[model samples]
Target: MTEPIKIDVWSDIACPWCFIGKRKFEGGVAAFQADADAPEVIVEYHSYELSPDTPVDFEGSEIDFLAEHKGMPAEQLRGMLEQVTGVAAAVGLEYNFDILKHTNTVKAHQLLHYAKAQGIQLQAAERLFSAYFTEGRHLGRAEDLADLGAELGLDRADVLRSLNEDEYLPAVRADQAQAQQFGINGVPFFVIDGKYGVSGAQDPDTFAQVLQQVRSERAEEIPA
Candidate 1:
């Protein structure tokens, strides 16, 4: 029996490009699945905060956050955001920057660890991205995270207890520490099979090609 290819993804709920990259990676997985020689794939998401210093409840728009935190001018930031919004739209993600709520994602990341233990990490991730980017829901608070977990059929009380007690905070920090060990300084970083690192929001074809190469190499390692 062959081992499944492991893909570790590091991303934050507040990251727009991470959501877009997720869609692209899904597309690549689907394309790989089309091949007769494709290997089984296992994907696991890790934690990486794009703005760890962001306040729990940021009092500003997306542009305002960038302008204040990143020192980017409003006019230039607007244009940059518009361009990224268009890119997100290309992959079927409607990025509502107008209603986007910028906040610290520590609780959200903790909730993800809870969801991962329940075997619904992907669902939880998609829910978080939608909540933050499209629905404009707040993800910084324990109650909001518990509510989001409930939406994915996770136990709300348990979610709240976990968040309140900081149950998964260690896991979240571990993921971040590992990211640093890998010298990863950005969100949406893809680590394939514990060796290859693909950074940023790359094209679907790029991921598909890399998967194919990994699969081929694995096949060659087996005894005839």
Candidate 2:
């Protein structure tokens, strides 16, 4: 049996590009798997807080947060966000920045770690991106996160307890520490087979090409 390829993706819940990248990567994986001989692929999501200092309940709009944190003019930020929203829409994501609740994502990251342990991290990540970007849901608080987890068939009480007790915090920090070791300064970074690193929201063709190249190399490495 061929060994499955492992992909580690580091992203933040608050990052707009991360969500876009997720969709593009999924598209690429689907294309690769369309081939009958394609190798199995396993994806694991890691924690990377884009703005660690952001308040759990920020008291401003998305523009205001970017303006203050990035030290950019609000008008310029608005224009950039508009462009991003357009790109997001092209990928079938309805990003509503107006109602987005900018918040510190440490707790949310912890919830992801918890979900990873439960073997539902992919669904959890998708739900989070949708909640934060499309639904304008609050992700900073434990109650909201637990509710999201419950919707994914995870035990609500256990999810709440995990968040309240900070049970998976160490795991989240470990992922962050690994990210630093990799010299990653951005979200949506993809580590393919732990050998190749693909950065940013690359197109589907790019991801499909990378997977094919990796598969070819792996096949060559086998003994004749």
Candidate 3:
């Protein structure tokens, strides 16, 4: 049997487009699975902090955070957020920008590494995104992350201990370092089969096409 294609994705839980891209990629996977020759895919999410310098408990609205960070006017930032919010909605994601809790995502990224060790990284990623974009849950603190992990059926105390001890910080940093080595300066970057790199929130068809193309090329390289 052929090995499944591996896809490494670098994204941040705080990134709105990453959630949208996740949905689109799922759609693509579903489409690819419908084909008889489609190979299995293994997706691994990497850490990429959109705003590493953001405070753990930012004392302003999402708009204020963006305005201050990007040096854009409040009104202009509002328009940009609205535009991205609409794009998120188009992909069936109910982005609650009104109550979105903007904060540092380092703890959340660390939790992801822990989840990966437990073989539930994808579920952890989904929960984190939903918490951040739709539910307005604060993901900056270790206690909050432990609660989130508990909700996913992970042991609450263990989660808290690991996070408090910063057990997964090195893994998170390694992912970021790898991202830099790959020259990836953006969120939602996709690397397929360690060769092809796809940037941004591309459409479902684009992902499906790339998977098919890679599968075909790899098959040709095998000695029959």
Candidate 4:
């Protein structure tokens, strides 16, 4: 039997490549788990805000957020979005820029905390990403977010009240502090086995190779 490895991923829903990274990482896990010699891998998703200052009710489109944040030309933003969308598509993801909704994800991260309590953090994360990216659903609204919790068997009223009371702010902050401690300056950063750090959404082959390496290292007998 292979030893288990921990994988901590720092990502945000507003990040296009984060979702892409999620898929790629999942593919890597699938490949590694199927390999006869591969080690066990446990994945934990952490929060990282890309647009922490994004307006809750911005009038402009999602692209406007990036342009304003970086002071980049609109044409340049368009080209960047197009290139990102192309990369997302290559990984079997559909990034609908036309219907994208940009908003502050702090509350969404709070909800992820609640979901984590229920052992559904990954599901809640995926729901929020799909809601904003593809479904054009507004996640900035508290009721809208609670609806997701209700679907996940969380108490709707509790979710609403938690949002109203600003719950899980500490967890969010702690994750941010951890990110800073690790010198993580980007989303989709992954840490494997609590010791190995992997930045970005590396190729599946890389994950497979890493899993193998970690397993082998675990098997080495030290001098007593």
TM-score for each of the candidates: 0.98, 0.98, 0.98, 0.93
- lDDT tens per residue, model 3, 129-188: 999999999999999999999999999999999999999999999999999999999989
Question: Over the stretch 1-224, how does candidate 2's per-residue lDDT look in tens digits?
Answer: 87898999999999999999999999999999999889999999999999998889899999999988889999999999999999999999999999999999999999999998889899999999999999999999999999999999999999999999999999999999999999999989999988999999999999999999899999999999
* TM-score for candidate 4, residues paired by index: 0.93
Q: What TM-score, to 2 decimals, does candidate 2 have?
A: 0.98
**lDDT scores for all predictions?**
0.93, 0.95, 0.94, 0.83
Better of 1 and 2 by TM-score: 2
Total clashing residue pairs per candidate? 0, 0, 0, 0
lDDT of 2 at 42: 99
Model 1: per-residue lDDT, tens digit, 16-55? 9999999999999899889776778899999999889999
Which window of ten consecutive residues has the lowest lDDT sum in model 2?
111-120
Best by lDDT: 2
Error of 2 at 45 (Å): 0.2
Each prediction's RMSD to truth = 0.9, 0.7, 0.9, 1.8
Between prediction 1 and prediction 2, which has the larger lDDT? 2
